[model samples]
Target: MTDETDQKDQAVEKEAEEKFPIGGCAGAHAEFRKGNFGTFVMRAQPVPNIVPPPPIAAKPLPPNDEIYAVCAKKEIGDRRGKSFPLMRRWDDGKLRPWDIFIARFGKQYFAYENACPHSGQRLDWEKNNFYEPNYMKVLMCGKHGAQFDVETGVCISGPCEGQRLTSILCFVDDDGDVCLTGINIDLDADVEPVKVVDPNSDEVLENNGFKLQSTKREFFK
Candidate 1:
């Protein structure tokens, strides 16, 4: 009776294997005789992350000190009919030209690009000139007669109604010579000339005419 029961169980298992076959694990339910087969499983691992740090602070700059270079004598005053523009020297022993009217406003200096921002012409009427007869007050442009504040370089009148003169800032030295603390240089020393073409005639002119030929003269006694 026991042999007959064992034979019956073996026959049932053999029938199930024949019906299910291999690759039957793909189905949601794996058909099997009770506890006849074991299942194998694989799991993926979690990945780790990396983070970066913030940037460091920068160093501060040193204080500004007045720089100087010798220009023509004080008696030379404004170079009205002169060929070259006058300049204040720099700490590095370089020259920087004047954009202000030296005659009307005395020791107090102003520096600007010699070019008129409006028409791209030289600001001077003739040579180192940038003023009218009553030269004691304001600066005047030579091209279309634009006027500016002698102190602030602000345009008060003329073709350039709303435009202010381009200023290059500088301070005066102990010897009353002008000193350029800024990065700008004179038309004579460092910077290259500004080039432009005339809209009407197609003639090209160097806007930096302040660099016209002239001998350097010393003003300090």
Candidate 2:
């Protein structure tokens, strides 16, 4: 016939490419002999190498009116007895849990205001402790036994003896963190609240927010 039907169609297209060898492996199944091979199908089921997660860096919002960053100056560690608790948020509407206390007087950083002008209570007799564990260098007032003066909270002896402890004019922010320079209250002087000074923190910056972010002073009772 016509050269035996063209050599039996080239021996059935070389026996369908030696039994389907078209990029086969994943449920392989290729066929072609009717039209003479030229379609397409080379699957390999097994895709996984996706990567995406890294973008939340916009940070520059630490001054809606005045300083307010509270941690990360090496975690306040120059060691002189160390202390912490400066969570602030002075009345944008309400909710005033208030507490300053940031002592570390060696590289300078007093703070105060944990309350205890003399029985107004709360000088941390335990929680984050206000000192007096034998002689952590007075500031002691774990509920009564007042001492103050970790660099001037005054008091001096117990029962509000000379009264003081209200301070609050922080610094250390160029990214070292620990800012809070003005507007805790008592406005005046052109409506208060307008500080962001830290000429290395000597020009005094002139003085001294919350909403669902629970930390509760980092737990431990």
Q: Best candidate, lDDT-wise?
A: 2
User: Which number leads on TM-score?
Assistant: 1
Q: Candidate 1 lDDT, tens digit per residue, 107-220?
A: 455655566667866665544556653543666665566777766777787777668766655556667665445443343454322222333332222222322222222211
Cα lDDT listed for each candidate: 0.49, 0.53
**Candidate 1 CA-lDDT value:** 0.49
Q: Each model's number of backbone clashes?
A: 3, 4
Provide the lDDT at 44 for model 2. Answer: 53
CA shift of 61, model 1, Å: 18
Where does the lowest 10-residue lDDT sum fall in candidate 2? 203-212
Give per-model CA RMSD: 15.6, 17.3
Clashing pairs in 1: 69-89, 72-219, 73-219
Where does model 2 exceed 4 Å of error?
1-37, 51-98, 102-109, 112-123, 126-137, 140-149, 152-221
